[model samples]
Target: MRISRLYTLLLPAIVACGGEGDSTSTTTSDQTLDVDSIAAAVADQNLPSDSLNEYLRENPFDVDALIERADRFIRSKNIPYAEADVKAALELDSLNPRVLLYWGDVNFYKNQTRQSRDAWMKCIEVDPNNVDCRLKLAELYSIVQNYRESLRLVNKVLEIDPSEPVAYFIKGNNIRDLKGDTAQAVRYVQQAIELDPEYWAALDYAAVMLANMHDPTAEVYYKRMLEIDPNHQPTYYKMGMFYLDQEMWNESIAAFTKATQLRPSDAESFYNLGYINLELGVNDVAIDYFNKSIQARQVNHRAYYGRGFVYERMGDLIRARSDYQQALAYNPQHEPSRIALQRLAEKMAQ
Candidate 1:
């Protein structure tokens, strides 16, 4: 019995309903039992280079003491202090690139998108060669779904420095969003990998593109990613999907089960497992898994549809109608649910 998991596409436009996708209906039960608080605790100290600390350490006499102060504030998530420090630095040196960059970052964290853009633009104006500023601005644009501008900015960075692996990674993402051209996206990511063999993000993106396309290179890249980072949850989940796609049911189940355990809060994993059960004719078990999937992800239309099908099989028309309607509520374009509802209606009329 080869259980096939759906080829789920990542939709950047869709904001997932936030919560742990657990099998319980209650809020507390829906939360993951395993809380890896250590990760959150060390998140602030993830990398000193990620702070302006390393940059400041190298360029000690870089005009603005306020920039370092702002970095400290930003790293601490002290928005007011960070903003005040940047403003004070700007007062002293209005055109300082470091100050502008920090200010832009603070603005971004604060969700002041327009202000962030303005600050980054100011930084670029002061230091046209500042790759960080350009890259950040490009990323900000991409976040706002302006892929064209993001691509242009990254292309500009590549024009200046052809060996910029980070730029290549961002360019690849933008290419995917704008054109859905997997080949071009893979090429850009491959360029990034060629520039920096240890580029894990590029490898992940490449793996995702290849896997979705059912390319033979997918397994190779996925194995390479695992070699670089064995415990990366996304890679594990993706590997599970790849196995499911390959009709390796036992392998898919193992991978998906591991993925769900690894990322307990991931709704998609539970949903995928449930989908596999549906294909495998484990109706009762499938129903249980689907219930968990819905509990984990309130807006998961697939779970609703699958549950509806199971309810139909059980000769429970009322539950079937409820699940079908719920599915339709989540996704009006869900054709399967619509057809199922129509059939149920016809059955009732008879």
Candidate 2:
């Protein structure tokens, strides 16, 4: 259950957009042109007015042009400008399916779920053949934990693009997370890979699913994902956990140590390292790692539990109880810490 919660916190970091080269020290001329065009489009639209028709009268091929503007504004996190751009595009071409789809995307980013759904509905109305919009709506629902709605949309996308790997990948993700049907999830992911061998997101999702399945084939998947994207943070963390689960202590320690080196303040890596060290009876090292883990995430119950275990082994009953109490304070159902607390209470009575 602790691992499950940890998975929730770590998912975004694993699937975050772009790589290290996403941001640049210098903007190129093309980037500057894109930004300027977008800013001008936003200025022309001037939301709160019905200026889209007038603007399009002057620039008839404006739908694609305005979309570029919206992209720039969205990337820059200029929400107001982005929203205006999307609205302007919609106003110019209300029947333009892609514009409506992007309107939904903008709303989704702004946390306007109902508005997003409305926009997606409009997109489907305009272009009943647009699978991408449906797929995106499904992903948005998944983000909010609306699995049933998500599944419906994804299934619709599959109906349109039968060979779409992403549709199957998302289907597998929802099944793996919500239903815990690992075997079915694994098969879906594998089918996705067979459809699109170079799909990195599908590969990454499959690697995680394989690891969770405790399958020996998980290493093959992880290594393949690493080959495609070496600096992927979640992949490293998952690899570490996989080794740890196998009780391959040295391999586990090395994987976790590398993970920490790559992401210095990651609490899970530190906590795992501390727990493993405590198990191996390296009390001083365990304490040091636990301290680092707590520093990274003060509320981490596993770090406190690992520290308590070390303290109990060292015959420090009072300190052990204190750490156990802290662990239970964070996670009441943490069985090891609860047992440690019970033993400490028995010792006190004796």
Candidate 3:
């Protein structure tokens, strides 16, 4: 089963709810577990650029410093450096529950799912009341399509700390996937938002859920999120999509335009701009946007098809035929391109 893993689409937007827990273990289980060698052994061999020169020099072996640096590395897209720091922290205290949580993340993004799961489970074993670890496990389960287990883990987290808003959020996602119940999902996510009004992920999820039902309140959530962080490009894209679906052309164009401004290389947003302009009969502007979409990503068959349609409408059969052929070359299974090619052939024969 192919899991959507929507949460990973922009991890910086929705981070783990875990705290920096004490490295010391309270449990007697795994009393002789060799913790020092684990982190380095599990450190992923990869490369991205980051530097913690001052921190490494001053607090060479401090777990907190290493974890902080690792965090910086992860944010900078330097997974290898983050892993190295995790390894260093683990070597100092292999059973450091906090470091274990981070190690889970290091492996999770590395696509080492089992390793990530094991690290989180170890964190839970070391700190029985670690709600964050439980939540992480639940999220990982949800990512793998194990919604039942995800729910079970989330329930455990709630039992441990009823005030944990992220637990409710995770539970909401799992329930939505398991039962396809958007209304129920929205209720749980809304509960999370009520508990922690500043929870961005909860706000984003609730808005998306409400939008699924075409609920007008989704607009409120979108506006609130923009108020909180106007530069969040994904939110703008979502707002654009919502507006587009509602046929609010001006609003959609404005939102998508803002999205493109924030993320110039976003092919979909450019393509959407083209689509909207095309629908509005702004032929020249539509062509320009379509061309930009193709520039953003060369393999965009949709952009080719859209441009072909525009060309055909402009009575430029040659350009339309060329674009249709380009679309087919990119995606041989493009039905619209095939039909357009046939239609053009008949027109040319006339």
Candidate 4:
């Protein structure tokens, strides 16, 4: 149950476009773009979020172009733009399945759960065999903890197309969430990989699940995932976490280093590096990492707490107390930092 809950937190139940305040760093280590990739993206008009003004200007009522632009906006996490495009598309053709699909997506990101569900339902009503919307509805049900309905939808998708990999993936995820039966849960995801060898989502779920179980076989899946999408932050972060848990110090550092290189503002990865070094009794390195974590994101209460722990260990009660107070300032509900401050106060009294 403990392992199950950990991975549940790790893997979000709802896979949707990022809302406001969600991480959407599209730059390199120092928050700069790769000039080559930027040039390539500019040249490649096929890129989802590439400027669509010319195309839309030529064919004002082209539902396909509107839907395409809406999808691109969604991908870019521009919910307002996406919603505008979705509205235009619906005005042009209210019954377009793709338009409905992205309408659901836009509403989902906006936290309008009922509207999102209704959009998807309307999509399925228009085209009963829309596997994408079906799978999406399944994910939605799972999000709302309606596991039985989620499974029913998954089973329906399987019946529609036995080879649908996402159906199997959803089944696996729902099983893990609903029942916490890891062994049973993973078999379905493995089946998903067997059906679609390059299914990145399934590979991630399977790899992370195995990692939680401390299974060395998780490395194989992680490697394949990196091969498929090397710069994916979650992959590197999760792999780093797995290595940290296994006490594979060098491996964890390398993975997290890559993550930080790709996303220098990733304070959590920095904090993990600090935690790992602290566990190894490398106080200097640990303090350096904790400092880096705090520098990367000043509101990172955990980083402050971690640095405080290192300070306390090094007999710097004043500094430790200051850090703890800073952590609490950022997040008053941070229990560990609160306890640390209390401990420091007691020590100072003595």
* Number of the top TM-score candidate: 3
lDDT of 1 by residue, 4-109 (tens): 1101112132222221122222122123321122123224556343344444446544546556655655666555545655665777787877777876766565
Q: Which stretches of candidate 2 lie above 4 Å from their native place?
A: 1-61, 140-156, 174-180, 197-200, 299-301, 316-350
62-139, model 4: which lDDT tens digit per residue? 888777765665555555655776787898899988888887777666665577688888999999988777877788
Q: Each prediction's TM-score against the native?
A: 0.66, 0.72, 0.73, 0.67
**Model 2: how far residue 51 lies from native, Å:** 23
* CA RMSD per model (angstroms): 11.3, 9.7, 8.6, 9.3
How well is each residue in 122-168 modelled by candidate 3, as lDDT tens digits?
Answer: 99999988876777788877766778988998898888878778888
Q: Write the per-residue lDDT of candidate 2 for residues 11-100, one digit (tens) a residue.
A: 342122111222222222133333345446556656332354345446756787676656655555565556666677787888787787
The best candidate by lDDT is: 3
Flag the better candidate by TM-score, 2 or 4.
2
Instruction: Show pairs that collide, candidate 3.
Output: none
**Candidate 1, overall lDDT?**
0.72
- TM-score of predicted structure 3: 0.73
TM-score of 1: 0.66
